[model samples]
Structures are given as structure tokens and as C-alpha cells.
Target: MLALGLNQFRKEHFWLYHVKPTDPTTYAAVGVILLSIALLPCYLPARRATNVDPMTVPRHE
Candidate 1:
């Protein structure tokens, strides 16, 4: 619904094509941003799991 409205708004206002596609440097920057976002969750979870309370959970089955 909102997408349709926005498309109509862009057509009426001629705003959609105002910005050009990013350059190579911008692509590199976006790639770095995406890579960092992908890795952050894995790193944070691994670090948190390493600090788990030793007393609360058995080390062996």
C-alpha cells in the first residue's frame, strides 16, 4: 500500500531519479559496511558464549 503511494508520489514530484547511482568508492564503502554488519553478530555471540557462567552449566555431559 505504502509502496504504491510512494511510487505515485515520486511520479507526481519527479523525485525518484534525482540521485545518481553510487561510484566505485561508494560501492567499496557499502561493501565494507555490509561485511561488518554480517560479521558483528557472529563475533559478539562467540564472545558472549565464551564468558558464560561456569557454575550454572555443566562443563561435561
Candidate 2:
């Protein structure tokens, strides 16, 4: 829904940029890049946490 709104807004201001606001390739590329960026930090920590013993986590508290 937000993407649609942004796209509509961008379409209105389309002359300001080179690429089309509704381009699927650009949207896909950006979505992948953003998803990776968002997931990386979370994944790294969770991956590291999985290596620890469940009992050890309680001991620290």
C-alpha cells in the first residue's frame, strides 16, 4: 500500500529523475538490497546466539 502511494507520488514528480517510478527492475533491486540490509544484522546475532547452550543463557541472568 505504501509502495503504491509512493509510486503514485513519484509518478506525479517523474520529470525530476531519469528512471521511471514504476520500474519493476528498480523496485526488485531495491527491495532485495533493503531486505538484505535489514536481515543481515539480525541474522548475524541470531546465528551466533544459536551456538550457545540454552542453560548458559539463564546463568547470566
The whole-model lDDT of each prediction reads 0.66, 0.83
Clashes of 1: 0
Model 1: per-residue lDDT, tens digit, 8-57? 54564543456324235555787799999999999998999889887767
TM-score of 1: 0.47
Q: Estimate each model's TM-score.
A: 0.47, 0.65
**Candidate 1 lDDT:** 0.66
Clashes by residue pair, model 1? none
After superposition on all C-alphas, the RMSD of every candidate to the true structure, in Å, is: 7.0, 2.9
lDDT of prediction 2: 0.83
Which residues of candidate 2, in runs, are more than 4 Å off?
Answer: 1-18
- The Cα RMSD in angstroms, rounded to one decimal, for candidate 1 relative to the true structure is 7.0
